[model samples]
Target: MHATQTPRQDDPLDVETFARPEQQRRFVAAMHRIAAERAPGSSVRIYVSIAPGDANCERWLECITDDLPDGVELLHYRTAFEGAAYDWDALASRLDGLVVIGRPKRLGSRVHVLGPVARLELRSLVATKPVLLFTHNHGLVPVVDCLSQVMPPEEAPRLKLIAPKRWNRESITIRAALDALRPTGVSNAGLESFRAVQAHLLTPFSAASR
Candidate 1:
């Protein structure tokens, strides 16, 4: 099914819920402006790529499909391995943004994930597209280390890796971030956290850009 460009009727709290009406108006305007600048005259076809076992993927997709703007569409790709179904050329053509979502391993646990991807493709992907990743790991150093290798000093300005704004509320920080990356293009919706803080983070950007 196609994604809606406006907020859903069922959501109790959403982008429309600013601290005030002015904030909401500005935020919505900013969103439109940003969209106009990034993908003028072009329709975006987004493809979501995520690990097979991720429980949050469904929730993330629901959030995205419910509120994507006009001209933006979302697809899904679930797998056990990285780029398992990746069609490099097709993906390149389809996507303007990507979100890689994974959990942090407990210190004493044997399950290893997230770190390697950060070690390996973080930079390459960022260089190629706007990438936003969220994880529970406290090791920011490793993320920085990997980014330093793959990202150019100049382009580094475009990369961001941080905690979810408020954990879980009504903000679509992930959505906003994806919008920032591809403007008029495709985006990944595998790791969205729409908490209060995230909503705050997105407000100014959305308002100003629209």
Candidate 2:
């Protein structure tokens, strides 16, 4: 099935809880850097997936599309309802990378799982490419647990973990989590591309702060 770009749905009661200004800045900066690195005349195609019924979904969509960089296109997809099977592979084939926004819930002492639809999308998306998961209000451990559920047993443990020094307050922590997936060998090209984006996101901000 073809991936349809979901229209932005506005909910009056929905509050801006996840997509913070700083995080949005970092995300957009990273996308711009990714776009710049593309071969001349080529565009970067990024598939952004969000769970169905997430109040913050439209917020993220707007943050990504607003003033988006040239040569970078975002294809937005809201995961299908529970028990619905959409052809994720066909969609993944046309994308350069994947970004999944999830709200992880703690199930146990150290276990976490994304919502049903988000978890399903995460499982499908990660099978072909490394996924950058943007999570809210959760730490690295919960995020790692979410990834482990979708990754192979051997590869899951091999995955690395990187966190900014002040992970609790920095948006770079999300980027660091994505970087940690390098050892799993999801997609070398995708990872390398993101490495450049990560550098671009961090270096300039670090320099300016100094």
The most accurate candidate by lDDT is: 2
**For model 1, what is the C-alpha lDDT against the true structure?**
0.39
Error of 1 at 173 (Å): 9.8
Best by TM-score: 2
Residue range 51-159, candidate 2, lDDT tens digits: 5455666666555433233234455553222355676767666666666554334321222344455455555655344355443333322122231434234423222
TM-score of each: 0.39, 0.40
Candidate 1 local Cα displacement, residue 91, angstroms: 1.4
Clashes of each: 14, 0
Query: Which pairs clash inside model 2?
Result: none
